[model samples]
Target: MKRILKRRVLIPVFIIVFGLIQFKTIDKVNMVVPAEFGILTIETPPKEVGELISAACFDCHSNTTKYPWYSNIAPVSWWMKKHVEKGREKLNFSKWSDYSEEKRDSLRLKSAELIEKKWMPIISYKIIHPEAQLDEDQRELLISWMKK
Candidate 1:
């Protein structure tokens, strides 16, 4: 009798807790802006190079990210939000005009170094966003542009 009562109480408690957790997860999603990178660099690269950068880097490292369907889900949305926030914190292409020349140069060098090491875009990101994976030619284009 006690076991049956305990089970009844535990089930409802679990359901209530789960509901609360799902609700709490909703707040983790950061508000997205309508505009993207207004100005990604001090000097715009050629159109081809610009496109390459957009495909490979802009989603995370810029002011804009086109959230996919999965991004609407709870934990995934939370994780993606944090990732974009961190990425933007590290390098916000949208804010290029705000950076001083020395800062831009330093960031370019760092960006190049990360790309050379195959550390940028991150593995998990590439797995889900295969379009974001940079081919050798694309990599070269970005590296060259950064150096320039």
Candidate 2:
């Protein structure tokens, strides 16, 4: 009887707490995405190359973030927003033109090295976004392009 009473009290309290928390939310800020930025701003690679880069890199590296449905939830949205903010801080690809030639070149080289070593597009990101996985061909292409 005591355990049952405790469960009854806790469940409703948990639900009420969760329901109240739902009031806070995040919005999609698609308007801020740069219309004409990304890897293309650096050079016009082949269609496949550009596609591969955009699929894997744009979400975090650029201002153009195509958020998934879960991004609307408060805590999850907050978590994702934190990631996006952190990613942009490390490298905002949308503003690629703003980078000096040397800085851009160094960054490109670093990106390629990470992909070649399978360190980038980190595992956590790949788990949620399967499309971002780089096949052997894509990996080789990026590595070769960076070497150039």
Candidate 3:
């Protein structure tokens, strides 16, 4: 009887907290991406490579994020917003023109290394977005293009 009473009280409290958090929505103001400043504009890759990068990296690494439906939820949206912010801070493909030639080259080398090690398009992202899941051939193509 005590366990049943405890669950009944705890469940309502959990629901109330979840609902209250919904008021604090994530800021989506930085979503607009100008095409002229993007990496594709400066150093255009092969079609397949471009497509692969878009699928696997753009959502977090670029300003033009295509937020999924679940992003409307509070804690999840908060986590995603922070993740994307960190990704952009590391390398914003949307602001690719701002980086120096040396920086760009270094970033490319790092990208290739990460992909080769299967450390990119992280597992959480891959689970939610199957398109980010690269097969051997696709991974090889991206790695080659990044090196080039």
Q: Pick the candidate with the highest lDDT.
A: 3
Q: What is the clash tally of candidate 3?
A: 0
Per-candidate local distance difference test: 0.76, 0.80, 0.90
Candidate 2 lDDT trough over 10 residues, lowest sum: 30-39
Worst 10 residues of 3 by lDDT: 27-36
Which of the two, 2 or 3, has more lDDT? 3
Q: Using Cα atoms with residue i matched to residue i, what is each candidate's TM-score against the true structure?
A: 0.78, 0.84, 0.94
**The candidate that achieves the highest TM-score relative to the unseen native structure:** 3
Estimate, for each residue in 1-148, the C-alpha lDDT of model 2 and write its tens digit.
8888779987889888877777877655844745465557557777887788789988878878889988877678878888888887888878877788888889889988899889888787888999999889889987787667
Q: Candidate 2: deviation at residue 80, Å?
A: 1.0
RMSD in Å for model 3: 1.2
Sort the candidates on TM-score, descending order.
Answer: 3, 2, 1
**Candidate with better lDDT, 1 vs 2:** 2
TM-score of model 2 relative to the true fold?
A: 0.84
- Give the distance in Å from residue 125's predicted Cα in candidate 3 to where it truly belongs: 0.6
Residue 91 in model 1: lDDT: 85
> Where does candidate 1 clash, by residue pair?
none
